[model samples]
Target: MSVETMTLQEMKFYTGTNPRPEDYEAYWELALVEVASSKTTMEIVPSNLQFSGVQCSELIFSGTDGARIHAKYLRPVTKGKVPVVFLFHGYSGNSGDWCEKLAWIQQGFAVVAMDCRGQAGMSEDKGGVKGTTYSGHIVRGLLDCPNKLLFRQIFLDTAMLVKTVAELTEIDSYRMSVCGGSQGGALALVCAALSPAIKRAVVQYPFLSDYKRIWDLDCRGSAYEELNYFFRSFDPRHEKEEEFFSRLGYIDIQFLMPRVQADILWGIGLRDEACPASSQFAAYNRLCAHKKMVIYPDFGHEVLPGFMDEGMLFLSGVKDS
Candidate 1:
């Protein structure tokens, strides 16, 4: 079946909610403009990883000062520049865990999933970037120095994964895409906007955008909890607040949303308290290229109700896949 475009009103009706005030949309637009104007430095280098043949193989990428980021790549039997999908993991999840979710043998796409720094429960995998976190890692020190946010390094690590995958002999450099759920979802949006190599994006239950709204709502997960703590501890007044959020503007979905030129498929749950529907819509509405959002009213946080068919259909049209 061909992908169908749905209007924002239809989305609200189907999902059973009214449109938020226009001011919310304005906030997203303003933040995005600043993010587009700011410059971020990214560096990529080759490294190694270990994966089990069934679904995973280890790969690594180097960040600033040779900090290594770990990754797992799953390749189909087909050879010669196959379409590629770079998968990013959510908060506290690892690369090995996403191998099954992103495996592409069935769809003829090459999949590479990367582990974010500092997450636990990893097996004897080598060369993965070590993440640093302690009690209250997420919100710890966020209010004072947004520049030192963990996501900054995570974004850099994700970019390095893309660059490494592009160099692999069996993957197509030009036809690559990035995808993930929640944290991964946010990263996918950033990669599509920042990297010229990305041609498609699949974001599911995305987190990290509409930061102020999310902070007010009090969502679950470290991403939100961290912000809550940061605000409680560090007090930013006027311009300081803007500078803190402005640094975040570099990675915020709204800021990155407009720069992304690829086709985008977004999955959202109306009842999703974790990421919230409004925040997800804020990002989807600002997308400049062809885009579609699949809303599941009865579902929250998980993609369901024809999501399987939709994913297949969306990826099928990606010329290289």
Candidate 2:
């Protein structure tokens, strides 16, 4: 019933985390270099949608293999440099899912929420960045080429969104932040780490941080089904883990943590049985940026109403005095 009831320790168990921070950091840095090297500019044109008091637009951006990616831009009615916040959805979700929770318009911030490629509730006609790799199925894709991993395209899409947001007329290029929950939270972490423009980030029960521990724990969400599928299909020896870790190094939050310069507000749900506390802790500890954490004893996976209010209050007044 209260925010205090939620705790991070319980959430860690529900999520999963065992690997050391050093391993995570080393792996992600390699991934960042690879991602940076492969990035290319693609055209993003405005769309036809329009909202009252806001300009609604869309973009056709470059993605894995030239697959067209779609994104929605929400701009303040007034012409000025407004702070920006980009919202990303969890697995099986899209930008439309977070319409009600957007605080950018009300808080005087421009918001752009993007749909991850190959997710549920997305336009089937529109191509996915790579392919669908849910939590339960993470391990299955390790064998694929690094470029083929779903997270790679998702991360690239996030970077593109940030780049695009900076170019928008209504947004201030210097003031940007990213926020999301679960898979979205993980993406927020990745984006915050890679993008220099983000001023702050608030992540809730983030996923894909510590890979080995989570796969072994076999947590609650269908996202982990990917891991189970991978193990059953291939008896990966030590060589496989070594190679997989090498590839995952680019995308994991640990390596990205040191790169993040923005202030952070991280939330951990005690009942989070999917993205565990240890992994979350791994990311938090590696953060070189100014950061703080909120533990919810009773909540799990989603950020509760109370935590949201607190996070907003913190975000509104987050500037250094």
How accurate locally, in lDDT, is each candidate? 0.61, 0.65
Error of 2 at 294 (Å): 0.3
Model 2, span 1-321: residue lDDT tens: 322222544433333233343455544456556545655544555556555676666655555345556666676778669887788778767777335634667787777777777764332222333434334334425677655565666776787668656765667888888888888888888888778878888778887776765655555246666655564567445446556655665556665677888888888865666776666776777777898887766767764657666666666664331
Q: Per-residue lDDT tens digits of candidate 1, residues 1-321?
A: 111133446534332122233343454355344444433332333324324332345565565335556666666655466887887777776665543744365677777777666664232222333453432434433555544555555555555566667767677788898778888888888777656578888778887776655654556454566554555557533445544555555446665577788888888877777777776776777788888787776677765677646665576563322
Model 2 weakest lDDT span, ten residues long: 121-130
In candidate 1, stretches whose alpha carbon ends up further than 4 angstroms from where it belongs are 1-56, 98-103, 121-147, 218-223, 236-247, 318-321
For model 2, the local distance difference test gives 0.65
* TM per candidate: 0.73, 0.79
What's the distance in Å from true for residue 300, model 2? 1.9
Number of the top TM-score candidate = 2
